[model samples]
Target: MRAATKENNVRTCLACGAKSDKGALLRFAAAGTIIVPDWRGTLGGRAVYSCLTTDCVARFYTLKRFPEKFFKGTPAFAISQGEIHGWIKTQAEASLAHFLGLARKSGVLTLGQNTLADILENGGTAPTAVLLAADLADRTLREITGIVPVGTPVLRWGTKETIGASIGMRPVGVVALGRSPITDRIVHYCAIVNHFSQEH
Candidate 1:
């Protein structure tokens, strides 16, 4: 459809002090005296937020004050910038791959260069979003961009080899995801990965 919009859960970034959607921010839940990461926001506890920008994430870890204001309580967060970044990055990637596997089982994933080319040239199931491998050929990218549905989010993700491995196939240059909870979560993890690195 269009760009993903914000909902009611707006949080201020602990690092940048900017207001943003919760899904776009990283959440850390309190556990005893440590601020444990709650990546998917699936935990129930006091929490704080930091937007997923490289600068914001860096600033967040360097905070001298624990920002009890944001968390609504004090927890001597036993975490480092490297830990947060690495943990979330690893989790986001593994989660994306896991969801891709689920998509395969659920029958909502489409891949293969020739198959995608044929589908784009002709007609078939409409994709909610399209993912092109990072090392995808420029010629194929040009062809696909010219044919991709307008307003559909197009992202460049893992290398052809990595992307293919995730879905149990040979090297794949492109993949189309259909609308479903699986796709939605894929998009969310994609956001986490992209925004976290910023340059990704």
Candidate 2:
């Protein structure tokens, strides 16, 4: 008898349709089970990797080619359509928080929201990304993005009912103090908050 070869866990890029090792791309798990692209490639769980950039992500979701593996039951089933989007938002926030926290510790970030907005308006400094609480209303990040829409923003997917009771829970942007690595912390926080919201 011949030994079984290792399963080819390598992923193919949805955009260029290029094949590469899993580590080369960002993976995300959608429909609660299937993996897609995490962009930052930091979020935990079963994920299918894809190359960075919105184009690749859009292709993966639009075609829904690989989703068959996880949606085999019930004939016409929808697992978690929002899972991939949620993961992306959470991961982005975590990455920003972590790095910003480090920068804050180093006394690099002296400006808060107002100052940051001012800088953005004046074309002085442009943030790489923005994280907003899902429940937050009257968001100003749009203006920042309009002036420089190239920046990405992470919006909260959980409601206040889920994370309202948590320590310093504010479903908007960074409340106070940045986390070690924004992506890691945001992902972890979203998981906990989402679990509670789903349970009770």
Candidate 3:
């Protein structure tokens, strides 16, 4: 995949009014009479952008900003804030899942506790982040956490079986995400997931 050029890559968030790389913001597109989250940013319609952070997302909803920004002079659709929030949460989770699958296919994912631990210990190039199974054993979690270098984020996500299936392997407790386009996307979506979880 060729790198994205700079000209069409910057977008201003409708909520925050701050400029950021397009990929760093969530894109929403009109779907029929209602606005919906556009996770892949490929929807064929006018798109509104917002920062993925909870503050921006919350401001977008709490201040009732979407109607003015999305509808303009057109008659407003009867869209509920709850529905939009649900869509945002669903899309965030789906984005994370989709990138994990891609990372696996591209050979940028390391599976199993020992494999991830080896990467951490041998440390020439380190993974962008580590993923621990939500139900991972306390002993294994501590062992892996101890080995991971400072400043690298560790995310607890999914069960061992679910994560393993995503990577086409048998159930495994730990995985490491290496540097790649997919890794960047995974990190972004993970932040959205974490933010929403904390707020609710």
Candidate 4:
């Protein structure tokens, strides 16, 4: 949940034993005797990593010791895999919404189909990514998908109302984000949410 990148940001997954970028994994840190999530990496403690997949998340907790004994003592832990997963889902959802709002306030957002289509066609600031409402009409989805340039991420999440409300507007189905640090973070959260949704 940390900012998608930190220097020396590499961490090993406690369950899978595979090395990956720290931002790609869920992060946990011990708070005194209670373990807490470093959802933003600002929790300021020694941290552990776990893959986002349910199997890995569950496996991480069932290990012989918490985070394989990274801590000095086995603090009595009561958290379950399902609870952790719920926290992750909620955090990721909120993070995405937070970034989207930031994008709008920062003037990096293009809203609705007509505006987005015009920008794409007329060569306005090319979007780095696109977000389509989960309930976007099929015809609009197809049209937008075909128009978006290759390699640009097209994330499908939230409904028209949810997406529009995030930007403080009426119901809108499409949102285009220009290049920005916030956009990159949005992409990262989208991956977590999308991957978790698929697995569940």
Those runs of model 4 whose alpha carbons end farther than 4 Å from true positions after fitting are 1-7, 67-69, 72-78
Runs in model 2 deviating more than 4 A are 1-12, 18-25, 29-47, 52-55, 62-79, 112-200
The best-first sequence of candidates by TM-score reads 4, 3, 1, 2
lDDT per residue (tens digit) for residues 2-72 in model 4: 66555578889988998888877878888777667677878776888888777888787777666445565
RMSD to truth, every model = 5.0, 10.6, 3.1, 3.5
The TM-scores, one per candidate, come to: 0.75, 0.35, 0.83, 0.84
Worst 10 residues of 2 by lDDT: 70-79
Q: Is candidate 3 or 4 superior in lDDT?
A: 4
Local distance difference test scores for all models:
0.79, 0.47, 0.77, 0.82
Q: Candidate 1 regions off by >4 Å?
A: 1-23, 40-44, 66-76, 198-200
Worst 10 residues of 1 by lDDT: 69-78
For model 3, the stretches where C-alpha displacement exceeds 4 angstroms are 1-4, 62-70, 74-79, 119-124
Best by lDDT: 4
Q: Write the per-residue lDDT of candidate 2 for residues 72-139, one digit (tens) a residue.
A: 33321132444544555555545444554455455443233566566666876445444444554555
Best by TM-score: 4
Residue lDDT tens for model 3, 90-150: 7788778788889999998888778776666776577788888889999999898888888
Residue-wise C-alpha lDDT for candidate 1, range 150-194, written one tens digit per residue: 898987778999888888888887888989999998988887777
Give the winner by TM-score: 2 or 3. 3
How many clashing pairs in candidate 3? 0
